[model samples]
Target: MGTMTPAQRRALYESARFARETTYNGPLGPEYTPAGTRLRLWAPTAEQAAVNLYRKGHDSPCIGTLPLQRGPQGVWSIWLPGDQHGHYYTFTVTVDGVARETGDPYARAGGLNGLRSMIVDLARTAPAGWERDVRPVIPPARRSVWEVSVRDFSQDAASGVRPAWRGKFLAFTQTGTTLHGDGIHPTCLNYLKRLGVGYVQLMPIFDFGSVDEAKPLLRQYNWGYDPTNYNFPEGSYSTDPARGEVRVRECKEMIAALHAAGIGVIMDVVYNHMYRYENVLNNTVPDYFFRQNEDGSLSNGSGCGNEFASERPMARKYMIDSLLYWAQEYHIDGFRFDLMGLYDVDTMNAARAALDALPGGRDILMYGEPWQGGGSQLHRYEANKANLAMLNERIGIFCDDTRDAIKGGCFNAREPGYVEGKPGSFWDVGGAVAAWCRSDRLPPHAPSQIVSYVSAHDNFTLWDKLLCVRYERPEFTASDPVALAQNRLAAGICLTSFGLPFLQAGEEFARTKKGVGNSYHSSPALNRLDWARAGQYHALVDYYRGLLALRAAFPRLGTTDRHAPEALQFFSLEQPLVGWALPAAPGDGAWWRALCVFYNPTDTSRVVPLPAGQWKLLSNGTSSSLWRGESRTYERKALLMPYSATVFGAV
Candidate 1:
C-alpha cells in the first residue's frame, strides 16, 4: 500500500468532522480503504495503545499486531498496508501499567456479540438503488409517528413473514406479507402503509449488550435499551452476526424499503447512558466520558449505571458527529432521544442546528422523553418538561401532561383519567386540545413542541389501561362496553388534539402486553405483535385508522401556532360533558369555518349547543370515513351518545 501523506491523514480526520482535533476530539475507530486501512483511537489517559487483528469475528488468537504511535491531542494512530477490510480488531490500551483490550466506541460496524470492532467496506453495504433511495417530506402538522420495535413487528408466526426473515432486518423489505396468508390482511411494511402514518419510530436498533448475538438459538429477547456500540446496527437483528457488513447492508435495505413505501424512519437513540459504566469509553479514557459527583463517583441520572458527560466538549462533539453520520449514511428521517431531558439545552440546540444545516434536516422531527429516570449531577441541565422553552421549536417534547390527562398517571395503574370519568382532568384535556398554549400548566412555546400521545412503549396499552379501570369500577368489567368506549375516547382525544400524534406499534388494534407494566425483558409471547388480536379487534383498528385519515385531510386540526390554542373557545357546560370549538380555514372543497367536538364520558347522554349553521358530521364515534359514512348535519344542539365522542364541521 502506498504511504498516506500527512494531507491524506488530515482529510480522513476531516470526514469525521474536525480536521484539527483538540483534546479528545479527533478521528476515531478504523476507516477502511482499497489500498490500506487507517486506524485511530482517543486514549487520553492511557499510557500506551496498540491494535490487534483477528482472522474471524469470534476468533481469540491474533493473526497480526501493530504498535500505534501517540500523537497530538492524545490521539493514537497507525496506517496498515494491504486491504484490511472485514478484519476483526481491538485496541489494547495500557492504563496504570495494566494492559486492557476493548472495542472502539465510534465503530460503525461490530463483529459477533459486538465484542470486537470490524473494519467494514462502506460501499459494499449499500443495497440496490440505495444511492437513489427517496425519503418522503412530511410537514410537522401532517406528521403521525408510529413507534415500533424490530422484533415485535414480525416475531409472531401469524405475522406471515418468511421463517428466516422473521425477527430480522429483511422482514421490513418483504412486501405483500400478510396475516394467515389471506392477502387481505396486510402486515409489516404493508400494514404501515395502510395505517397512513408518515414515520415509524424504530426502538433502539444500535448494537446492545442485552441479547447475545452468537446464541440466537435461544429465546433471547429485549427492548434493546442497553447500547454497547452507538454507531453500528444491532447484530442480532442482522441475518448473520459473524459478518459485520451483512448487518450494515441489511439495515440500510430496511430503511430503503420503508422509504420506498413513503414512510420516513425515526431512530430511537439512547445516548444518555451506556449499558455498563466500565465500557469502551471508560476503558480508553477512564473517568472522562461519564459524569462524576463531588465525591469522584459516577452519577446515576440515567438510572443505568452511569450517565454520559454530554456537557463536555469532546463528548458533545462525538454525539453531533454520530448524528451527522447517521443522517448522511443511513438517511435517517429523524431522531428520538430516549431520555432527552438528561441532555443540556445547549447540546440539543447545537445538534438541531447541525442537522438543519444538512439537506432535508431543517424540518426534521426530533422529540424525546421530557424527563429523566433519576436526579443529575449538574444543577441546571434543562432536563424536564418545565424547561421546554429553553429548547428550539423544532425540538419536540412528549407531552406527559396530555398523556396522563388522557389516561391515568403513567406510574399509577388505578388512577382514573378524564376518559375514565376522573373529575378534574377535563381542564388538562382542554389544554391538550390546544397543545397547552397559554395555560397554567406546562406550555411549550409552540404546538409543534408538544407530542400528544395517550399510550407508548413505557406505559400500559390504551386498551389495557381501560381494562385496568375495570378493577376499580367493577361495573365496567371485561364484557362491558365501557372499556371499549374509553379506549376509543382516549384515541379520539389524542388524535384530535393539537400537536404531532404518536402511537405505539399495533396501538391502532389495541396491542397489549398481557397487563405487564414493564416488558423490558418479558417473554416473546407477551411482547410480539399478536396478529390474532389485530383480527379480533378489527373494529378498534378501523376506528383509529379513520381518525388518522381525518387528521390528514384537515390540516387546520394540527395547527402549531400558539395563538391557535388561544382561538379555541370552550362551552359553558360543566362536568360529564367537555365541548369546545376551534376556527378552521376553508379547505377540502368544503368551507369548514368551525369544527366542534363533544366528549361524553358519563353513562348518560349529553347535548352540546352549536352555532346556527349547517354542520357536517365527520366522526360519529365509531366511523370517520371521509366519504362513506352517513354525513349527518346538525342545526342546533347535537345529542352525544353515552360514553362516546361526536364531531361536527360547520358549513
Candidate 2:
C-alpha cells in the first residue's frame, strides 16, 4: 500500500471513528534509509512536536533539534538529510501547552534502561543464517508447551550453564549441557528434546521496564510483565546491552538454537498495560492510549493501574502490527498473550487474520489467558473465551476448569481438588476431566481451542501446592507416598487429555517456589528452576516423560475434532474411583484397539472389572511396562492402588 496523503489520512481516521482497523494509521516511528531517517509521531492531542537528536552516550544537550511539521489527523513528521543510524532520538510534544519528552512507542531499539529511542538499521541486527530460520509446524491438538523464563532457566548454580553464558539468552544455545543426572539427565536444549514438548512458551522478552538494561548484573529481576518497548528485545538478557543490535541478535540466535533442537518458540506478549503511566505513548498523547472511565479517570482493568484501549482504531492497529512484526522479524512460532481478555474480540480476530495471511502463518499457534484481572468497559461477551464461538479455530484459551479441578482452587490454597482426595470433589473433577479429555463437554468449535494444564507461571507449582495443602490439613503430608502418587495422577491426566497440553518449566521434576504464591517480584533463589529438584524427583520426571511418549504414540488421545462424540466412557460418576475406556481407531500400530484408564485416590486398593477382553497393563503408577503377557482377564478384576493411576489396553 502506498503512503496516504495528509488529507486522505485524516479523512480515513475520521471515517473509521471507533472501527477496529489499523489501515488508517500510517507507520508512526523512525523509518531508516541510507540518505536519512524519517521520524513520525502520532500526537493528536499535541499542538507541537519536535525530534531531538542526541550523540552517543549522552542523554541531555542534544546535538541538534528539528521541528516536526504538522500533518493531518494530528501526526508530526521530520526527516534528516543524512544517515542517522547510530544516533539516539526522542520526541518532545506539547499537549495542552505543556511540553513533554518521550521515547518512540514503536522504536525497534532503546538506549540505556530505555531512556531514549535509538535509530537502528534492522538489517544489520539479524544473526547469521537468520534468513533461513524456519519454525517447526506443530498441530494444535498435538502441541505440548513448556513455559520458561529466560533468566530462571539457567540462573541457578546447579543449572550447569557456562559461567559467562549463565542467565543470558546465549545460555539456551549451549550444546550438550546436562544437569543433575549421572550421565543420564539432559539439560537445556537436550532436556527439552527429551521432555517431548513441541513448543517453548517463553516469558516476556520484549523491552520491559523492571530490569535496568544499562546494568544487567545489578541484582534486579522481573518476569517482564511491564513492557517498555513492544517491538524491541529486552537488553538485560543480552551479554551486552550497550549496543542495541546485540540484544536483537542474541534473541534471534536463541530462537534459532531452539528451532535447531526441534522446538518451536512462543513469545508471551503483554499488550494490556505498560510499565508506567508516564510511558512513551502516554507522554506523547496524554490520556489517549489508555481506557478512561465516565469520571475521566484511567481504567484499571489490567489491575496494573492503567489498561490499554485496544478497541480504539490506532491501539488495535499497533497491536496487530506488533504481532506481525514479531512473526516475520523474529520468526516467532506462536504468541501467548498475557491478560488477553482485556482486549476486544475484534482486535484478536484481526490479528489472527493478519497472521494467517503471512507465509507459513497457518502453522503459527495463538493462545492466551481468557480472563482479565478486573472489570473492563467492553461487555463480558466481548472477552476472548466468552466470545470463543466468534473467534477463529486457530485461537485457543487456557482451560482453567481442568486446572482447578485437578489441583484445587487457584485463589485459595487450602481447598483441595479430586487429586487431593477432597470429599465430594470426584464428581465435578471427573466431569471436567471428561470434558477436556474427550473434547465433547464444554465444547468449542475444535479441540485446539482448549489448552489444559494443572499448573503454570501464575500460581503455586504442583509440588508446592501439595505441600501447602498438607500444611493446611493434618491428614496430608508432603513427603507421603500417597501425595507423590497424587502428583503423578495429576500429570497423567494433563498429558493424556485430548487438547493441547501445557507444562510450566521444571514441573516434570516437581519444581517449587518455596510456598510463595505470586513470585513475580521474588528473588532468583525463589524463581529459578532448581535442577537438583529434578534429581530428587527423577522418578516423577521419568513418569512425565513416559506419559508424553504415550500421548505421542497414540493419536487417539489427541483428537483434533471438538464435536466428535465422547471418546471416553466413564464407568461410574459417583464413585471415588474413576474409570474410562478409549477405543482405538482402525489401521493403528501395535498399540491396542481399546484403552482403559483408572484413577484411585483412596488409601486402599480397588478392584475394578474391565470390559470383555484381555487387557495389557501398559502403565501402573510407577512404570510403563508394555509387556503383552502382563494381562488381566476382563471378567477377572484389575487392581488399582491407592492414590494412583493405571492404564490398560487391549487390541
Candidate 3:
C-alpha cells in the first residue's frame, strides 16, 4: 500500500490511542552508508523540516540546506548521496509557521555543549575489548550500591588521583590511586573494590546542559539532572570535550575498568524532563514531546519546567531506545531513573522488557525515585512506586519510608530517628525495618523491588543528619563517640536489612556536606568526598565492612521471599527497642542457623529477650567480630547498650 497522506498522519498523531501503536515511528537519527547519508526526524506538527549542514564547527555557516519530505506517521526523511561522516548538522523546522533550529535529539555524538549533532562512525567510539565487556553477576538482594558523582568523586586534591585524571572518567581507570593522610588509604576504584560494593551508581553521566563542555576551568558544577542529550556521555567528564569520540571512549573505558574490578556501573538517567522546554524535541515538534494542559501550557511535573510525554508513541520509543542504547553500546549494567514517577508505567515496563531482551540483561538492575517533585495531569496510579504492583518484578523503588525512619526526617533534619535516640521513633523505624527485612509489611512480590537506604546523593548525609539531631537535642552530643555509634547503627540496619542496600559514596567514612542538605551546586570543597574521613573514622569504615561481611556470610538476610512461619519472628515491638530473628534457609551454608538483631535507641540500656537457645555475639555497637567459639548463653534475655544495635547468632 502507498504511504499514508499528511492528513492521515495528523489524525493518527492526534488520536488518543496513537501512543500504543507499534509501527516504525521515525528514523534512528542520522545513518551514513556508502550510497548516502539518510536523515529522518519526527516532527508531526512542523510545516516543514530541513537539514542545515555545517562543515566542522557549529558556529560555521551552513554549508547546505536540504529539504526533507514528510512521510507516514509524521516522519520527515531525506537522503544526500556522497554526504560522508565527520560533518555537523542541525534541523531547521517551521513550527507554527515560524522557523526554529535545533540539534537532533537522537544524536549519538554532538558538538561541544551539544549545540550541533555530529555524523560519527559508531564503530570508532568503542574501546578495546568493548564487545567482551560483561557485567558482574550480583543478585538484587545481595547488591550493595555505592552512589557517586563523576566530578565529586576525585575533584579534591586529596583524592590522590593523577592531576590530569582527577574529576574525569579516567579517574576510575587509574590504578593504585591512594588518599594521603596518616597512612596511605585506597581511594576511587581501589576503595570501592575493597569496600566490597557490587554496584556503583554514578550520577547522571549523560550529556547534561548545565556544564560548559568547551571550558574545563569554568569551575562549573552540576549533578547532571538536566539532560540535553540522552544517548551521549557528558563531555565535561572527558579530557577533551571538543571531540565527541573522547567522551564516548573515556566513558566506556571507565565502565570497563569498573567491571574489571568486579563492580557494575548504574547510570543515573533523567528522562522525566529536558533541560529546557524549547529544546530540540519541542522546537521540532511543538507540544508533541511534552505533556500539555488544556490551555496548552507544558506540564511542570518534573519541576524543571516540562514533563516528557512518555506515553506518546515516539516519546516512549525514544526512552526505550536510549536505555537499550546505553545497555548495549556503552555496556551500562543498569539504570536509575530520576523522578521516574512522572513517566507512565507502560514506558517503565517497556524499557525493563527491552533491557531484559539483551545479552546479560537479566542481571541488569533497574530502579528509580518513585515520586515526582510536582503535580502532573497524569494519573497518580501511573507513577512507578504508586503502580509498583504492575511494574516488572525486577524493577526497584527507593524506600523513602525506611529512609526517613532511619535518618530522622528528610525535610526536617532535626527530626530524630531510631539512631537519633528519638522517643517513640522506634515505632515507625521498627515498622520500616520490618518491612525492609521481612517481605511482609511493604509486601513486595520480589526482594529487588525495594531499595533501602538512609542517605543518598540528594538528602543530608547520615553524619550531617546526626549533627542536626545533636544540635536540636542537647542530650545527643556531636562527639566522635556519639556520631560513630549512630553511624554504625544506621549502617547495621541498612546492610542487614532485607532489600537491596544502597549507600551514598562517602557514607562509609561518615562523609559530611557541612550541613548543606542540597549540595547539587555547592563548591567542590563541600561536595567532594573527604578521603581524610576514611582515616579519621577508620573504625566506622571497618564497621561498615563488617556489616557487609556479615550479610555476605548469612544469605538469609537477603532473602527475596516473604517470611515463612518460622523464617522471621519479632521478639518485641516496643518504642526505643526492637528485636527479631531470621532463620537461615534450608540450603544455605552452615555459618549459622538463626541470626538475631536487637536495637536500643534509648539513652538508657534495655533488656532484649532472645529465643530459647545459646547465642553467640556476632556484632555490637562499637565493633563486630566473627564467631570463633565466643558463645554467651542467654536465658531468653540479652542486654543491649543505649542507642546501639547488636547482632547475635543462635549456635
Q: What tens digits encode model 2's per-residue C-alpha lDDT throughout 1-651? A: 343343443344345552333235578788999899898887776777898888752445788878999877677889887978878988898865678988998888877777788898888887888888888866543578999999888887666788778788998998877774346666777678777788999999998998877665537778999988898898889887877768888999999999988889999999999999999888986666677765556779899998887877778888898999899989999999888889888888889999999999988889899888897765434546657777787788898888888889888887788788887766665665554534344545566677889889998888778777767543321355666787888887777666778999988887878677889888878888888777677888888877777776666655656653266777863377788887775554527777788887777888888887777787786774443245543544788877777887775
Ranked by TM-score, top first: 1, 3, 2
**In model 1, what is the error at residue 340, expressed in angstroms?**
1.5
Candidate 2's C-alpha lDDT? 0.78
Shift of residue 452 alpha carbon in model 2, Å: 0.8
Point out where model 2 deviates above 4 Å: 1-25, 57-61, 180-184, 216-218, 436-444, 473-479, 585-591, 625-636
Where model 1 places Cα greater than 4 Å from the true spot, the runs are: 1-26, 472-480, 585-591, 626-630
Q: Give all candidates' CA lDDT scores.
A: 0.81, 0.78, 0.79
Worst 10 residues of 1 by lDDT: 10-19
Which candidate model has the greater TM-score, 1 or 3? 1
Worst 10 residues of 3 by lDDT: 1-10
What is candidate 1's CA lDDT for residue 56? 80
Per-candidate clash tally: 0, 0, 0
Which of candidates 1 and 2 is the stronger one according to lDDT? 1
Instruction: Give the deviation of candidate 1 from the true structure as CA RMSD.
Output: 5.6
lDDT of 3 by residue, 45-131 (tens): 678899988876445888899899988767788887884667788999986567899998888888888888887777777788888
